[model samples]
Target: MKVGVVTFPGSNGDTDCIETLKLVEGCEPQLIWHKSTDLMGADALILPGGFAHGDYLRPGSIAQFSPVMREVARFAASGGPVLGICNGFQVLTEAGLLPGALLRNQYILFHCAWTHVRVSSNRSPWLEGVEEGTVLRMAVAHGQGNYFADTETRRRLVEQGQVAFEYCDPEGNTSGESNHNGSVDSIAGVTNEAGNILGMMPHPERSSDPLLGSADGRVLFESLVRSMAAGAVGR
Candidate 1:
């Protein structure tokens, strides 16, 4: 699978995502600049974590206008698999590819630490084949990763099984304390209605190797590869 990792001006996680993709069997990664519209015929797309345009105005405010994002949006509308991590999550929301917004951390701090997230939904191609309630170990580094949505939207996400990941304990239990960043309903990640696009705060790219920490994140990446091989994309 050819995965395109988008790199906005201030994107710092593109290298990490690319390196991780290189390690995933059968994953071919291509670095994409924010200015380019050509997708290079990528099988999947990844908007890496970073402070695009220094996160000026808002986390993804500026980056949303990038030319590449138009292409990204187009691909997403076609049901292509797209994963947005951290700032990428913000961008997805801002671009209207996904619902909700990433507000500033409630405590007003740049929270960086490993967190436990349980799979709330695996309907998306990105998390396809991942069992619900499976706890995953991933790291989050962001100052504005608190996910928020309207009351109705939140309820819909839950009822529709679009809540992809939720902060939880190692045992797969969620609580106020377990929900880092105070995201509503412990939402660490969510997928679009069609389930092809996902916006997540955790950095799975950084957790692909046990040397760095837990390799739990590798499961999601591998899931994508497996789903694609099975011709289950755009689901």
Candidate 2:
């Protein structure tokens, strides 16, 4: 698998994503520059987290207009597997690839902490082997990681099984204080209608290694690799 990680002007998580991809056998990771239009034959693409363009004009608003994002949009439209982390999720929403927008944290603070997210849906290959309600420990670092969508859209996402992950307690309780960012329905991640593209606020790449306090995030990458080996579609 050739996994490409796009590096925007201020993106800081590209290297982390590359290293995480390297941990998976048969995975060749490529670091693509934001100015480059070509994805270099990537089987999957990751838009890692960071304050792209210094988060000017509100999070990903400026970065979404970068030259490479045009190609990213095209690749996603073709059913290619695309994963967007924090700022990347903001970019996806700004680019209209994902349904909802990311708002600033309800507490208006840049939160950096370990969080537990439960696998909420199996509609995408990214969760192929992860059982529903399985809690994964990951780190979330962002000021605008809160997810927001209109009521109808939220309902549609749930009904269509597009919800991928939800902020929850270690025991898989999604209510109350588990939702630190105050995201609607505690949504930590969600997939596009076709389940090929995933946008989430958590940094799974950062939590993929044992040295990172938790290896729970490995399940997602492992599942993706297995899915690819089995010739599974993102759907």
Candidate 3:
């Protein structure tokens, strides 16, 4: 499978995302600059984590206007899959590709650590390998990872099963300590109405390798590849 990893001027995790994807057998990731206007025929697109524009305007405010974002928006609208991690998730929300917005952590600190995530839905291709309610460990690094939306939107997301993942305890349980960043309902990741777009503050690609101490993230990526490949073959 061919995936496109986009790089903005201040993007820091572009290489990491590319390397992680390349590590997957038969999966090749192409690097596209933020200035590029096309997707280069990639089957999927990943907006890797980074401090684009140095987080000048907002986490993803400046990035939403980049030339590459136009292509991303177009691709997502056409049912192409797009995964946005960390800053990438902020960008997706800023670009209007995903729902809700991210705010500073309730504690107002830069958080970086291994946080557990519970799969709330398998409706998205990105979570096909994960069963609903299964908990997986993922590394999260961000400051403004807290997500918020109006009550109606949150209700709609829940009703539609667009809530893909949530913060959880190490024992696969939900608790106060399990909810990092004080996100609303402990939401860690979510998808669009059609389940073609996914955006989350946790870095799944960062944990695709077991040597990195957490291989749980691989299932999400592998699921994406499998789901997309299946769609390609009319399955």
Which candidate number would show the highest lDDT if scored against the true structure? Answer: 1
**Clash pairs detected, candidate 2:** none
In the range 166-212, model 3's lDDT, one tens digit per residue, is 99997678777888799999899999998989998889888888898
Which residue segments of model 3 deviate by more than 4 Å? 232-235
Instruction: Give the per-residue lDDT of model 1 (tens digit) for 1-235.
Output: 8999999999999999999998899899999999999999998999999999999999899999999999998888888899999999999999888999998888998899999999999998888888888999999899998999999999999899899999998899999988879898889999999899999999999998999998888887899999999998853
Q: Which portions of model 2 show Cα errors greater than 4 Å?
A: none
Candidates by lDDT, descending order = 1, 2, 3
Give the per-residue lDDT digits (tens) of candidate 2, residues 1-235.
8889999999999999999988878789999999999999998889999989999988999988899999998988888889999999999999899999999899798889999999899777778878888888999998898899999999999999999999999898988699998899999999999988999898989998999998887777788788888888742
**Candidate lDDT (C-alpha), each:** 0.92, 0.89, 0.89
Clashes of each: 0, 0, 0
RMSD of candidates 1 onward, in order = 1.0, 1.2, 1.5
lDDT of 3: 0.89
The window of 10 residues in a row where model 1 has the poorest summed lDDT is 226-235
**lDDT-best of 1 and 2:** 1
